[model samples]
Target: MASSRCTQKYAVGSPASSKASPLPSFHRFLTKVIQMNQLHTPKASRNQETGRLSFMAPVSPPRSGEAARGGLSRRNARRVKQSAPAFISSPCTFPTVLALKKIAFTVTSAALLSTFVVSPASAVDKDASANRPKPPAGMSRVGGELLGRTGTQVKLGVGAPVLPKDLTGRSWIVADAENGEVLAAHNPHWRLPPASTLKMLFADTVMPGLQPKTQTYTVQEKDLADLGEGSSLVGVKEHLSYTVHDLWLGVFLRSGNDAVHVLSSMYGGIPKTVADMQAHAEELQALDTKVVSPDGYDAPDQVSSAYDLTLFARSGLQKADFREYCSTAEADFPGAKKKNGKRETFKIQNTNRLLTGADGVDPYKGIAGVKNGYTTHAGNTFTGVAERNGKVLLVTVMNPSSKEPHAVYKEAADLLDWGFAASGKVTPVGELVPPRSASTGTGTGKGPAAAREEDKGKNGPSHNTEAVAAEGDGGGGGGVGIALGIAGGVLALLAGGVFLVNRRWPLPDLVRRLPRR
Candidate 1:
């Protein structure tokens, strides 16, 4: 009986030990499953596009070492005693995928930063294009011609073609003084009489050389001879004398032919003055201009084109002294000395209808000094400048209708209105240089057969020459043809004009009028 009891006790103890041993095997199997799953779980490719991570069905409970398989039944029995929640509590094996997502986000963030940094460089280039100039077509050749022929050194680019066919007259040209771009053209190469408008060039060139004080000059018999009885005059008496400065004032303010001769002679004779004028014109390359007379009296060989005239006007306006002269609507020339040396003060007024507001034309709002010219050859020509809203414009109207100066002024206003409209309309024409007609009479000299004894002293000196012959004297415009010539635009005195409009902004309406090509 004692031996049997001992054997039973040993068997019970063995069962308890076996049951406890299963617990360690289950723990080891769980650890092995985690390691295997970690090894087998796929790592996403580095190049994968960004987004969310999707999970594959939970990987097959990884095949375990044999011990794990063997313990499952015992563990299941034990787990059945415990709660099911406690057994299922480990991480779902998704941490590795989470790590991969973080890495992708970091890479995506870096790529986004790089893209933002490089974008602005392209935008700056686009902004630069807006302010760049467009080349006007046919401009290069015109520029070359201006530089080569007239000494007007205008340089230009291709913007729009300026067709010559649309123009009228022997030659025609339109330019924007503010912008300096030639808008339309015809036979711009031809040279014709610039007439009295040439005086503007003389005034502009000589004003700087003047000493401005106490420079004395004498009036000669030649100065007073055969001055048209009815034509305008400063009443300079022969053998009388005046300061050189006053003579210039008279020449510019009154358009005095006598003062012109006196001044021209004082400036080293007409030839030297003419040469100087020509050289200056050459310097500017004003090719079509030939300055034979400082007064711009209707010399047959002296001629200028519409284009060259614009250049001349532009070049002259640059001088302050020149501006003072033409701008003077009224001035006092301390009287001419009589042959007996008596002094008398005389008032000289500018004949430019625009300056004096003599004609019906409305005065330009901000107009400064300029000259007016009319001759049988060059009818109703004007070179003018005006400023408004901090912008300056130089304009030239050559051979507009003599019957109406207002017509020309109105046309000029139209151009002015157009220029103010845009930023890019008129290109500057080189440098701004702001810068006359005649007739004969019916009366004969008061001397000869019935020479009136009282008239001899009152009517001034008498000459016996035929009145027509006297009327046709020096620097005077050819007569009889003006009225007839005006009727036919084909004649030398055609009623056409040229205008130059320039500004900082493109001229408004300028583009609308440009040639289609």
Candidate 2:
């Protein structure tokens, strides 16, 4: 057998070319065998077959005068020669069995690594999905199973007025503000665009941190940026200063995106405001709501249910300021200051037709302020609370099918009328459950009536009847149990997968095993 000499070179930084340590004895021996086989093989044959060692082999430099025939330049060829490893000598014979064995080992190692490495990432994703609370299905049975049902749900006693025949809202709810009982509902848990009605939640979240009369912010150009095209505006002007009271008036009265943006900017920015609003919604147990824009502009995935909107109204009414702002039919908003330094003012009226009787809509008797919203997509959505005699009722209507203008207000008013007439004549379909913290004894979960009773005991009667009627028990849903159940199942599956993988591969380094009995 004639002996042949060959030299292998690797890229400067590749693992094969690394000078950190000499190759293991088995790898060195395999390298020598593969190089000898390559030296004897024809150039075309070598190109056609990709042996395991081909990646480690350097191209052979051309013989004398070959460089002049369109090969590497003299300087580059010299560098390649200098970088080449020491020459090896061996007989030319292909080690077919050994090469096949190495290739099989390489493929097996890759598969094992991928199984262990990628599985944990996939498991993490599954765990995250399992941990997030789902709406309607996974949410707490706040008002029992009746509120969670799909269609109309109500319990009418003998002679109780039938639900308004013309009610067409996709989702509607009627509940007693006194005892937290749901009087009637239709698709209460159906999530739909809430439009400006979501502003009620926004107000409940940001209002506490601000002092309407004391805290004032000068509007900046940046405050008005990204307000969504054709959004409702209260004509908020940049470079002008307005008290928080004026901004809120603009919000409740005009359903103004400009005022919303300015208020959100005062808190932090839109991102922070959105995050806070989301947190507040979760706390309120408004599980069906997903807040994408603080202003409630039509955006992807932003939705709320009639059940949740009613909860927002009930929570908001607990505060006196919220009651005052929502009920005010009209207010003067601050405008540009004149040259003489007196600030100009303009009148803005509430868009809630049931409150102001605007747009040919009749004002509901004893109607207190809540919120109303409309968008091309949302159509019309409203949540209102009203009092009759000494009893208070809350009603929410969303997305009526009728094309007539002011249909939402008409439907809500009808529902309110039915709720008052049905009082004491019908059993509640479900009761609004108090907030998780309240029911769990961690916070005050009392609705308006309970709070009023407490106040009467201490202060001897609440003379403010409007405040008393607007107030309602603050309650929300809880989904921790559902989330935990899903998480536990996922973890069980993960453990079983690990056990099977360990039985086959035996990762002693990662998972220690007990001794067999």
Identify the candidate with maximal lDDT.
2
Tally clashing residue pairs in candidate 1.
58
Model 1 spans > 4 angstroms off: 1-179, 183-190, 223-232, 336-342, 401-406, 426-517
Residues 206-281 of candidate 2: C-alpha lDDT, one tens digit per residue: 9887865567789999999888876778889999998899999988888888899999998999999999999888
Q: Which 10-residue window of candidate 2 scores lowest in summed lDDT?
A: 480-489
Tens-digit lDDT string for candidate 1 (268-346): 7677888888876655446558787777766668887665666666556544455556667666777655688667776
lDDT of each: 0.45, 0.61
Candidate 2 yields a Cα-based lDDT of 0.61
Error of 1 at 150 (Å): 17
- Backbone clash tally for model 2? 5
TM-score of 2: 0.59
lDDT of 2 at 380: 70
RMSD values for the candidates in order, in angstroms, are 37.0, 27.9
Residue 141 displacement in candidate 2 (angstroms): 4.1
